[model samples]
Target chain A: SQTIHQWPATLVQPVGSPLSLECTVEGTSNPNLYWYRQAAGRGLQLLFYSVGIGQISSEVPQNLSASRPQDRQFILSSKKLLLSDSGFYLCAWDIGTGGTETQYFGPGTRLLVL
Target chain B: GQQVMQIPQYQHVQEGEDFTTYCNSSTTLSNIQWYKQRPGGHPVFLIQLVKSGEVKKQKRLTFQFGEAKKNSSLHITATQTTDVGTYFCAAPYGNNRLAFGKGNQVVVIP
Candidate 1:
């Protein structure tokens, strides 16, 4: 069975500080990875998606960025965080061709920027 | 731009009562997938419908895909407190990335 893991289940960062959240999937290779943010009282919002290593598509422009450094490893980062950046970050994987596919998600990371 | 919307942003049902949520898409979709998220947990895949007017069932839950591929619905029979959570319907709009509906928050009262 395939499983996804995310680091720092919960995080607290100061405004203007750097941010890094990691996601790794075991038991799957070349899977499509995605980054999503869910704000309180809001639905999930797609931020970035990667088809392969070094290939990422930005869904929405904001203070965050995502990278697929390794086939099974995806990272969401920001050089300087903003108060609006605080939200629940989720990592998802999909096995699809041509960009239309079903996705599986991770436990997620809750970030609070003060 | 493609968009999906769900009706009844929140629904409160008495345990054992029936419940249904509707999903509508701004543009035609190739397929639609359903997911359920517990209060504090991640979303879990429920089922997927592809063919037009397709209907699939899992135990007490029934899913339907509209003939126009522009709408869908999820119906739960005899709801239970365990069924309390948010239900989301998602569909791919010409690409692999799926656009999800705002979701319907279901609260089952025991």
Candidate 2:
């Protein structure tokens, strides 16, 4: 069975603080990774997705960036957080095949930028 | 990037009532996947629909893929409080990437 894990389940940081959220997947290799943000009562917004190590696709232009250092390790980072950055950050993975992707998400991290 | 548009972004259903949410795409789709996310939780994959005009069911939930392959629908029967969550439909965009619908937030009233 494959499982996804995320860290800092809950985070509270002052404005202009740096941000680092980590996600790791077990039982899978070369999986496609994605980062999403959901605002309060809003829809899931795709922030970044990585096809392979060091290959990232940005969906939204913002202060946040994503990195895939290892095959199954993905990191979402921000140099300086903005108030608008407060939201639920989720990490997901897919098999990346057949031109069809079914995503499995992690526990996610709730961020509050004050 | 392809965008899947879902209708009735918010749904308020009375217990035991039946309701449906729709997802549409301007271009034909090879497949579509559904997911459910509970309050304060991450999204979980529900099911995937392929083959034009396909229909699949899971207990009280029925999923349909349009014959044109450009639309999908999820129908839930006998709504329960356990069904309260946001339902999102997604389809492949670019190589191995999926574009998710805005989601239909189902609020079940007991």
Candidate 3:
């Protein structure tokens, strides 16, 4: 069985502060990893996705960026935080290919930028 | 990029009553997938429909893909409090991206 893990579960950052959220998957190799954001009572927004190590595709461009340092490790980062950046950050993984496959989500990291 | 639209951005249903939410696309889709997200939680995969006009059921929940392959619908029978969540429909497009509908946020009143 494969499982996804995300950390800091909850984060509170002041304006202009740096941000780093980590996601890791276990029990699966060469899986497709994705990063999504959901604002309060809003729909999921695709942020980034990776197909292989050192490969990252950004969906919505902004100050946020993503990097896949290893086969099972993905990281979302920002040099500075904004009030609009507050939302629920989700990490997901799928088998075989990318987006089309059944995706499994992590517990998620709730970010609050004050 | 291809996109899907969901009707009734918000749905309020009396517990035990039945209702349906739809996902429509302007272009034909290879398949459609459904997911449910509880309030304050992440979305979870529910089911996927591949063939056109295909209908699949899971207990009280039913999923259907249009014969034209441009739309899909999800019908839930005997709605319960546990069914309170946002339901999203998505389809693959381009090389490695899935287009997602805005989603239908369902609220079941007991």
Question: Which number leads on DockQ?
Answer: 3
In candidate 1 chain A, what residue range of length 10 has the lowest lDDT sum?
A94-103
lDDT of 1 by residue, B1-110 (tens): 56889998899999999999999986788888999989888889999899999999999999999999999999999999999999999887645587888889998888
Model 3 lDDT per residue over A13-42, tens place? 999999999999999999899999988887
How many clashes show up per model?
4, 0, 0
Model 2 has a DockQ score of 0.69
Ranking by lDDT: 2, 3, 1
Best by TM-score: 3
- Model 1, A1-114: lDDT tens digits are 999999989999999999999999999889999898988756788888888999999988898888898999999999999999999999999885733666899999999999
Q: For each prediction, how big is the interface RMSD?
A: 1.7, 1.8, 1.2
> What's the CA RMSD of model 3 in angstroms?
0.8
CAPRI class of candidate 2: medium
The estimated TM-scores of all candidates read 0.97, 0.97, 0.98
Model 3: per-residue lDDT, tens digit, B1-110? 88999998899999999999999999999989999999878889999899989999999999999999999999999999999999999998876677778899999999
- For residue A31, give model 1's deviation from the true position in Å: 0.4
Worst 10 residues of 2 chain B by lDDT: B92-101
Output per-candidate TM-scores for chain A, rounded to 2 decimals. Answer: 0.95, 0.96, 0.98
Please compute DockQ, using alpha carbons, for every candidate against the native two-chain complex.
0.63, 0.69, 0.71
